[model samples]
Target: MPKAQETILEIDRSALTHNYNYLKSKLQSKTKFLAVVKAFAYGNDAEKIAKHLQWLNVDYFAVAYTSEGVALREAGITKPILVLHPQIVNFKTIIKHCLEPSLYNTNVLNAFITVANEEAQTNYPVHIKFNTGLNRLGFWESDVDYIINKLKATSSIVITSIFSHLAASEDANEADFTVNQIKSFKVIATEFLSKLDYKPLLHLCNTSGVINYPEAHLDMVRCGIGLYGFGNSANEDKYLKPIASLKSIISQIHKIEPNETVGYNRAYVAKTYEKTATIPIGHADGIGRHLGNEKGYVIINGQKASIIGNVCMDMIMVNITTINCKEGDEVIIFDGNNKATDLATSLNTISYEIITSISQRVKRSFIE
Candidate 1:
């Protein structure tokens, strides 16, 4: 590996391909696979991941916005792209790039209808997102008729897919709640499709739903975290490989005497003489300040090293006395052995926060 000048996020494309194939094998042969590559492919590199997935013949790609979809398109990705949370203001650009938008509100639906008609489009593909239980985005069940009516009024707008999100698909204890959500989505979707005289592709299973509720897998599945080797369950984790690894080199090492304080506000007061290795990464680089004050740790030489004090804007101090490490040694922030989920648990957050929180400032390196 090249010498680490700064914190680097290493992306494993082979592991990503493995995860994609594993998830694809779990679904029925007829079921299509939609790879979600939003949030810079969850803080890795979207264009890189999308290119690899394209090589794997992924059925579709989904992003949170039109800009993300455009990025993939510009990267020569010709596969169908779905913008999950598109805004009306970008409807023109979305259409220009042949990107499909998930119409979750009446205003958005109307705006798309106007644009489609003005553009003289016929049978333009779009997804309708229903609010199952997430309550974040998506049209409510009561809005189904309005959506169907609007679509019926315009031949330009075509319903390509209908989907919903599961709020707690990974929890076994939330099985009943998830079941209820699936049932509700099915009922609303069935009623709307019956009125339309045609059926669009139906998909509700995310990574968690694909693992926990096979029955909920409808016409397709959208796998995001699963493609990145996080299944939200121990069983799934065993079968997956993390597609990203974060590593940083120790910039310098200092031997501190007993009673000496470390970092800002004297957050870490040494009780005994110890060696500290300062790494070139910090909250500004998405490590977060909460990771300081001994709240989180990184792995060095296969052993845990705790953060000694407040995480600076571009540096962190790790107690490395026991590790026998020196300056320029590589430290593992999160990887296959010590997962980011472990750090998230320590900081009382989820792996998504830990992964997505990684800022663009951190350099990204792709390993094929």
Candidate 2:
């Protein structure tokens, strides 16, 4: 709420806690919770988010890469970290940091085994990902025997969990597909446990999956966007508090005549006398060019101000003619009232794209 800062991303810790508790309320007491803090916690500062979740006693933390896990460890994150897409070269670092890698394929499984053995690690914990239906990652269900054979061939890494991703748990039309995917995962998990002589945690729910498929909440659940206050559905979004609010201030105001044009390529031509407000945020700041030329709008004086002209690398122009706003007036790009989901929908995208696309250069202010 600083008056001078041109652009700032405000992170509400209370909202995050509220979201966590709300999501937790939906789960049984014994089901573990894994907070996905990958992509810098969806560009909202993963270190801070993870630290808060750690204090809340979240059962686990997951990231998209080993480097993300290393960053968390360096930041004093002591809880077990799961690297979702760990690379073979980073296996040593993963072991050094005591991070668990999701071995989705035979090559990665074998490569991680080599590293764990070389490091003299015994019974190192690793998670197995099954290709239930996503087909993006994970070993095939048909390859379950091969997976078990590989695991039995080595005691260097132990199976800690078997998980997979849900592609469309949020879509009501895909209910049948989601159910089938869950069924396939259950069969694979049961076979794996029967063969391994040990039971690893089973999980197959992301945010949407957590909401739509409670029965599939085997032993744990992974939540990413839901933790940040987006449910991917209007009804669910009504119950979640968005944690991040992207705000900025009008740096300058201009008066233009009917003949005048604005921005690169003269994207905007005034139809009449118009007042414009230049905000110090643009494509470089993650408000992409796709959001320009009246495609996106900002809230000024609690009124909508359409973004006019093309978005520049570090600035954007909004038609503030009717808002009666001056330089330094606060402008909210997206927040609870003007939801990021709505903004992304206007751009033919999703809330995740809009929220995570916020650039790191923008200052993040945490509110507790």
Candidate 3:
């Protein structure tokens, strides 16, 4: 990829392909693959990422909201786009875009059925979500009968898949918990499918689950972070490559004298003389305030330059005294080398939070 001239997120398509293939290798040949492109494909340009995955012949695509599904539809994603969470208000728009909704609860299932009837539709495909362990969303095991009966009343809608979320498939300590969740899902699936005449696809594995649980692969798998090049474990990370590289150029360099202060509220005071570089990226650009005052560092001329003082809305000052660098030099916020995982670890966070937090205002360039 070319050097950054400004604050830009470089999207490496080749890395994305490699990650997809790596994850795909873990599944059975007949199993389906659903690529989760929610949160603007984890804040790396949804349309672009979705389009590339579509080209890879991914079986399906998943987004968190109706708008995201609609965006995929508008981008010419003909392969099924699953709206993981759909508001009742957007039901009509979702139908209009041919986006499938994951009916997780009584209200959503009933509301979607009503909308399907109003639209005068027939066999409109939808997915069912059940809460195995993740209490965040989905219906309970007891709701299976209610869902079956609800579906029995409507020819306007059809269940395409029944799925659940894995709470902690990545953690070894949570192995038993993960296994129980998978077992619960299997029991739910057996009962749910036995009642219906046709069989829809069943999926429960997220990225880490895809690696850790082969038995839970069911009929399909949904991959999100893994496609962005994070395997959720050190053992699996070497097999994948992160697709987004946040980079910028040094706007200016300041030579501070002893006792000099920097940034808002004089957050950093020079005990000894130091040189600082102002980078055109900060809180507004998704660089959090917690990263300020030496919590985070950037790669300058292959050397570490620790971030100093408070992070401003659109700029961050880094102490680069020892680095032999100047204005307009390339700066690596996070890349395959100084990984996003490393940055997130320093802040006691996860790679998912850090990558998805990248602001939309930053320019994007694709390594096609």
Candidate 4:
């Protein structure tokens, strides 16, 4: 690998393909794999990743907004794109880009119908989002009848799939709650579809759901984090490989005497003579200030280096006394060896936050 000028996120396409194949092998033979490319493919370049997955014959692609789907389309991706949290204002743009919207409520559904009709569209694909237990978005079970009735009245809209999100699928302790939510979703889907004389593909499995609840893997599975590696459970981790590796180079080195403080606010007072290396990465680069002050550390020369003092907006100082390295040496922030989950645990956060918090300023280099 070439030397990095600053913080760089190395994307391993081989690992991505490995994780996708692993997850695919775990799913039922009839279930389709929908790669969730929202949040820029979980902060790792969505367009490129989506195109690669499309080449691999992925069943579908999902994004959080119509613009995200539009990006994929612009990249020449022809796979079916599902917008999970589309706004009413973008319904026309969504229709124009041939992106499917997940109508979470009656208002969105009605608005999409109007736009589709005005555009002289016929059988435009749309997904129905049901609020199983997340309580964040999606339509209520009671509104199923109203949704079906409206769909029946409109000829331009077509229900492509009915899906729900899993709130606590990763937590084994929440198994009962997740099971109940799955049961409720199934009941509502069955009752509502029967009344409409329709059978849209039913799906309600996320990364953790697919791992924990095999029976809930109905017709499709939407996976986001698993594609990037770091599964919800320890067992799942054995089968997944992380695709992102964050690396930075040491910008400078300093020799500190005993009792001397490092960085702003004198947060880290040296106990003895120590050598610290300042890396060209900080809060502005997604290494939050909170991660400083002894909350987190990085790997240097195969050894752990404690982050000393406040993490500046553009730099961070790490004690390199134990490591046999000099200025311009490489340092690992989070990678295959030092998992993002481990860093997130040290910061009292989750892997999702650690990965998604990576700023766009970091240069991304993909390895095939």
Q: What is the C-alpha lDDT of each candidate?
A: 0.91, 0.92, 0.94, 0.91
**Against the true structure, candidate 4 has what lDDT?**
0.91
Q: How far is candidate 2 from the true structure (C-alpha RMSD, Å)?
A: 1.0
Residues 107-169 of candidate 1: C-alpha lDDT, one tens digit per residue? 889999999999999999999999989999999989988887787788998889999999999
Error of 3 at 330 (Å): 0.5
lDDT of 4 by residue, 151-269 (tens): 77888988899999989999988999999999999998888788866678899999998888999999999999999997977788888998999999999999999999998888899
Task: State which candidate has the highest TM-score.
Answer: 3
Span of ten consecutive residues with least summed lDDT in model 3: 68-77
- Please say which candidate is ahead in lDDT: 2 or 3: 3
Give all TM-scores, in the order shown. 0.97, 0.98, 0.99, 0.97
Candidate 2 structure, TM-score to reference: 0.98
| Model 2: CA > 4 A from native | 1-4
Best by lDDT: 3
Backbone clashes in model 1, listed as residue pairs = none
Clashing pairs in 3: none
- Cα deviation at 325, candidate 1, in Å, is 1.1
Better of 1 and 2 by lDDT: 2
